[model samples]
Target: MTTQRTITVDQARQIVFDAYTTGLPQAAAAKLLTGQATQAWVTSEYAALRRRGIPAMSGQGSLFDPAAEN
Candidate 1:
């Protein structure tokens, strides 16, 4: 049997930031922090990190190849 952990926002922040350097997604960090990957909270937390001036592990936005069509 496994036990679940209860975490606070500060802990979530730490998980997000530290795990980000390890290529962990916001949802993944949320999972480690809150035991479940909630997109809403993950997104808000990610934005909070950005507001604190922490750059994401990867540059945002991907270069779309318009030439590739279905």
Candidate 2:
């Protein structure tokens, strides 16, 4: 049985990112959000966040990233 994606990939990333910045443990955050706080889920979400160049969920951000500059 396949479960429908209740949240989009973007939603998943934002949810995880918000939890990360708040300093909540990943497991707790995942459970609180998706009902399954598995390491694999967290890892995948984090990877997607980085792939999009979100600058790590360190609670600090800017309109532009110097690292993205060529």
TM-score of each candidate structure, all chains considered together: 0.54, 0.49
Please state the error at residue 53 of candidate 1 in Å. 2.5
lDDT of candidate 1 over 6-68, digit per residue (tens): 777677666676776556777677667665447687788777777887667543222243554
Model 2: per-residue Cα lDDT at residue 7: 70
> Could you tell me which residue pairs clash in candidate 1?
none
Off by over 4 Å in 1: 34-37, 58-70
Against the correct fold, how does model 2 do in TM-score? 0.49
Model 1 local distance difference test score: 0.66
| lDDT for residue 68 in candidate 1, whole number 0-100 | 46
Q: Give the distance in Å from residue 44's predicted Cα in candidate 2 to where it truly belongs.
A: 4.3
Residue-level lDDT of model 2, residues 11-42, one tens digit each, is: 77677888765555667666766654467888
